[model samples]
Target: MSITTLERPAAENDGDGDDGTGSGVGTDAARATVAGGEAPAAPTRIPSKEGVEVGPRRRLRESTLDERFNILGALVAGPTVATLLFGWFTPLTGPIGWVVVAFLAFIGFYILLVSLRSDREEVKDRVLTVLLISAGTILFGALAFVVVYAVGRGSVALPHLNFFTQTMELAGPLDGLDVGGISHAIVGTLIQISIALAITIPLGITTAVFLNEIGGKFARFVRTISDAMTALPSIVAGLFVYAAIIQLITHQRSGFAASLAISVMMLPIIIRASDVVLRLVPGNLREASYALGSTRWRTVWSVVLPTARSGLVTAVILGTARGIGETSPVLLTSGITAVMNLNPFSGPMISLPLQVFDFVKSPEPNIIARGFGTAAVLILLVLLLFVIARLIGGKGPGQLSDRQRRRVAQQSVDDLQRIAARNHLLTPSPAPTTQESSP
Candidate 1:
């Protein structure tokens, strides 16, 4: 007769050789012994161990309640302690000294508070964050001071309508702020910078394209030359134009000569900046263009330039800013002229910077006020230029305008219609059956 034994579940096995959380190996051995076959030699199994330990959960970016309390305490203590030390014990005087000491105390207190709870790495991270924030605040504060100072001193001259309309050609040195304006310098600056941009934009972008698209030993040489020239002194550019163009070609100081000098300074900046921008264009884009059998020049014009247009505009803006503020080059090449000279090729022109320099040279208080006003105007002009440049070329890659979107939609429709027509024409027609009576 055959026999079958019902073994107990491993949950009942206690202090047995199969020791890993009731795996039931003891029950299997018992069943095997009950069967009519010789029992198999006992197999060894390594007990499973849960050895992995999860570390404490913490967030790097988020601030804890304890951290917030620490910061608040430090802020209050830093200023209070610094004031007491300065007022009662130390010889420190002035707002600047108080602020300096307070900031130092703030840092020290913050470190101590943070160290109480956080480990070394966490303390270091919090300290670095405070330092970075303080540095940024100081930088912004200095910028604000400059802007506020300039605008405040110049505000006296900005109220009058005549300040925007009239020129210094008629007004004397001792005249009131309303009587004279930087109109001549404004017009002269516009013309000179327009000419300079005209010269620089084409040459700069072309040179940048050459460096990226058609690179060779000559391209490397050009890049090196551009790098060297980026740091070239403005005075040297002025002298170069002073000798080469003013002395030889124009034979006099003129707005045209000033523009040449400005272009010399601007060109290298544009090329180097543009090259960096172009290098950021993805290699995949160029390869795709090539895959479509596009010529190198065509691919650059359509694919690369459009993709990096905004960055190129930024490069141009940097060059423009650098060239516009240049006093020495404009002074050396254009010379000063009080009257409006629209013709750049023949006569002298005075830009905003040069005009400011001229105004400050006069010891009269009114003239000094005019100088400040001119500086304010320059700042406003620069801001306006930035706005216009951004408007012109601010679109990022793959972002299309409404017109472009409509055009793409129309193209897709046309392609679909054409594909449908081709499919219909290519369809096989059924063979005509022979007429065989009623068969």
Candidate 2:
């Protein structure tokens, strides 16, 4: 055997070994044979553990709840320990100040700990997440505190059934809680808000529609004015109505005047918000309506409005909430009255906000309690309005209730049957070709 033939069998045997050691030598021999020349160079393998190939170690996966708990515990415990140790040396004053210090310490410790295990990018992400969660918790905690405080303080007056049924007319500032109620204030609030809504809803919605649907120089001017009016102060609105309508036109401060002032505050909000909502309506819907030969008014009425109904309702509720809580305008326009005035045209009215303001100013504890109660009622009323709006607005455009769905299906079937009947009537019947058919 030649020298090459003697070595070829050894190379083949090495290639057939269970270990991957001789892979490069066998590959080189095969390439040499294919080239019909000297053998190619053998690649060298770096020494590894027990002569076996090894790779970089992968970080362990932490998929269990326990792993997560440990991480969170570390993040919390490290900062707490540091805060306590530091506080032992120094001193913290307010609870708020302590919280701020603890938060800062926690951020520093958390970033340091995370950086030890995680990459820079992951550390940044975790830190941001903690910050956002902390911010949200703080915000919600403050809101919850306010609500709890209001409810706790107001509970004293809320237990009396007479508070809902009677009026403050008979009750003196120092009277016991059982003797008087906020009925007059409630009634006045309802009436004033009702009048405001009646005036604002139509005008605001129309203005929004005009701004969105009609694009003229005048429309642009109106939009600009509306945008500017959104920031117009509540006191300014009250003053405007006081000067223009109350002083110049009506020469009286009545619930009507209050309603006008509220309308002034509410209109800009409703118009601006509704305009935003209406603009969000898809252009495809309008195009489809036009394809079906619908006029601009019909498209707006049937397609655009229906599609944006829920959003428009939200806009209205937001505006109402804004106007309802306003004190200055109601105070300026509606002179305070303890007796209920059901009529809006002639007499002064007291809304819950104004009533609360009035009550809290007195030195009497009972009156202050009543003010808190009225504030709680105002909050409840706002929540109630939101619920009512949700119910009335129902679902969005493509979403329908069971009854609505059934009605639409039935109407569709009826239309199809009617169209078939009309086509039957329009078609000419076969003439007298019976003899030719027989043949």
Candidate 3:
């Protein structure tokens, strides 16, 4: 190969050296070629030294407007003006209306969350996501307050023993009417919820398993329809049950009708919840079971279900809670009677929620108070169901065995000892080393 020495260009010695490190030879060759009246070929790029930069890179700065005050001030002003104008045009209904409006206002405030503003932007998205959570708490607290206030006011009319044992005999004196109890409503609620469980549990779990585990295109379609069914109104469900059984068979309300209606309403919720929980189970568990020679159904029943049992229990509890409070469906499907009836297959039944509706609608103040008592009982029952669900999930303190606890304690002690030994070794200790102790 012919050798030729190329002279470096003036530009190569310039300040651009800081920008074009490691490419000095290429720059020199290009300069010599240009000097020889030939077009300079493309310069070869030398890999720059890693992590060393000679100069700061240029950056573009964007201009932004300050609209925090103006935007928020406008948001407040618009609502205020509208509320004033509308209140003038159509009178405000009172505290209830204001509370509802405040709730709606908080929804708007919630929408402002997840909104981005650049550094130069003056808008402050002041954690409106927290508003959604706070609004939910406020709504629930307000509800609780209203119930407590109503109960406190109504308790004066509620006779002491009458709240528990007697049936509503709407005859005789008003004092006699006060002699009735919620035993019938309590029995009805339990029977109805039980029947609903019997109808929903197996079918819902099977359907959920099929959809989540073995589902194909058709199963997916069925799941989609089931999800849609969850949103169906309770009254509509009652009407469907009425049309299916009452209109075709008896043309009358009964406990069976109520149970069927409640089951229909509950099925979608159970399936959806169970399906989601089952889907959440790690695939590895299922594979492990199968690898150990377990069949598909056995794998599901033993491994998959157990792994996701806690969530499934929660799903069942939630479904029970939803069905327990259903008034419209039970009202349409089961005739409400004050007397206690236990047979779900035969006879009219009365649930707590339906009784509350009937009792509250009655002209009698004592009946209204009884309605509040029923509501309180229903709330307590739902809360109890939650507690039971948590317990059944094996999260109870009693779930820990003595041996397991002892093991845990021993492990903790060992860890502490290890830590202490490590610290002693790290420190300049006068104590003999392990080698010295070995002798």
Best candidate according to TM-score = 1
Cα RMSDs of all predictions?
Answer: 12.5, 12.6, 15.4
The sequence of per-residue lDDT tens digits that candidate 2 reaches over residues 119-194 is 8998888789788988999999998888788878989999999988998889998789999999998988889889
Q: How are the candidates ranked when ordered by TM-score, highest leading? A: 1, 2, 3
TM for every model, in the order presented, reads: 0.80, 0.79, 0.63
Better of 2 and 3 by lDDT: 2
Candidate 2 clash pair list: none
- Once fitted onto the true fold, the runs of candidate 1 whose alpha carbons sit more than 4 angstroms away are 1-62, 401-407, 417-439
Which prediction has more favorable lDDT, 1 or 2?
1
Using alpha carbons, what is the TM-score of model 2? 0.79
**All candidates' lDDT scores?**
0.87, 0.84, 0.73
Once fitted onto the true fold, the runs of candidate 3 whose alpha carbons sit more than 4 angstroms away are 1-125, 157-159, 170-173, 176-178, 250-252, 396-439
Cα lDDT of candidate 3 equals 0.73
Comparing 1 and 2 by TM-score, which wins?
A: 1
2 or 3: which has the higher TM-score? Answer: 2
Q: After best superposition, candidate 1 residue 299: deviation in angstroms?
A: 1.9
Error of 1 at 284 (Å): 1.5
